[model samples]
Target: MYNVDDVVMYGTFGICKITAVEKRNFTGEEQEYFVLRHVNSDKNVFYVPTDNEAALSKLHSVCSKSDVDALISHMNSEKLIWIDNDAKRKEEYSRIIKEADYHEIIMLIKTLYLRRKELGAAGKKLRSSDENYLNLAENMLFEEFAYALDIERREVVDYIEKHIA
Candidate 1:
């Protein structure tokens, strides 16, 4: 259970704060909902039912700077299992996104980055869908990384590069 002011990563919403937790009878029965506000926005808000298991699955604790450091170092040897079959690739990537695992998200980014470079050298490009996935993964990662490290989102690439170097 999260309390007010606690920062958390909520699925595709990226970093958010638990602004409030109130019990209401909106559905004709009293239930609790977690009121969240996006860290980057003041107007955007979300209400997540506290008792909803499926929705709660997407809520995750924010990672720390050390966690980010270790992850980047580990990424040096990790590889993305490229699925040649389009359907399988899409399905697998979709599952990873739904699962909202930063480790897998980083792997996805690495895989696509390498694949894009390989294709670019061959005078080819990734399928548009793969490109979109890359963008999505990067956004998710950058948001969390920026929040965790107290850096700007644009600096995430340079940070990772410095670590990779």
Candidate 2:
């Protein structure tokens, strides 16, 4: 259970700071929800049930700068797997994004990039769902990394571009 002011990853919502925790009446029963505000978009807020399985693990800044450095160092080498069917790929990518795992996000990004490159070489354009998934994955990862490093999302993007290249 997270307390007030705790930052947690909620599926695809990315890093959210717990602003409040209260019990509200729901269908003749009382349930607890965590009021969270997005770290990147301060205007966006979400109320999550305390026991949602989609709410995987909590991310804490236990790693030192060297660990972050190592993660960055390995960013480019991450492998991305491509699914043949668009619908199935979208569903799978959506679930993976919601899990909010850093390594998973890296895989998504790398996969998308490689897929795009392959399609480009074949004189084909990326599908709309592919574009959407790429954007979502990038935003989610950038937001979390920005919060963890105490930097802006743009800075995180710049750092990733530099390190991944």
Candidate 3:
């Protein structure tokens, strides 16, 4: 059971702080739920079902320096080939973001960066959906790394820029 003030990851909700854990009467039975406030949003709270599988299995931290290193390494790999179908590509990217893997997030960031550069070279720009996915993946990875390293998220970005650029 998580205590109040514990930082945890929630499915699709990203990182949150467990502000409260209280027992309440649910249909005449005692039940416990976590009151979680999103780390990145203002005044956003979630009542997380204590028994929800995804919530229970949520990652508390990246923990391993190797994970961050691996992510950086993967980001430097050859860019992915652009998918011809926009809808399919968006779906695949969404799935990759939701998986919340550090390496996958890095790959997404790398792919989108390359895509943006290529588009710029061709006198084009990224579509709104592509921009959203890139921001989401970058934010997710940054938050996880910052939490794990007990550093500011901006610091993570700076570190990545300095080391991985």
Show the lowest summed lDDT stretch of 10 residues, model 1.
73-82
lDDT of 2 by residue, 62-133 (tens): 234455567789987787768998778988888787665668777888899788898999999789888888
Ranking of all predicted structures according to lDDT, beginning with the best and ending with the worst: 1, 3, 2
lDDT string, candidate 3, 36-106, tens digits: 88887858887766876675665454345566666665566746645679999898898887677666667
**lDDT over C-alpha atoms for residue 151 of model 3:** 79
Stretches of candidate 1 exceeding 4 Å from the true structure = 25-28
Structure candidate 3, residue pairs in collision: none
Best of the two (2, 3) by TM-score:
2
- The superposed Cα distance between candidate 3 and the true structure at residue 63, in angstroms, equals 4.0
TM-score of each: 0.95, 0.80, 0.77
What's model 3's TM-score?
A: 0.77
lDDT of 1: 0.91
- Of candidates 3 and 2, the better by lDDT: 3
lDDT of each: 0.91, 0.74, 0.75
The candidate that achieves the highest lDDT relative to the unseen native structure: 1
Q: Show model 2 residue runs off by greater than 4 Å.
A: 40-42, 52-67
- Which candidate leads the pack in TM-score? 1
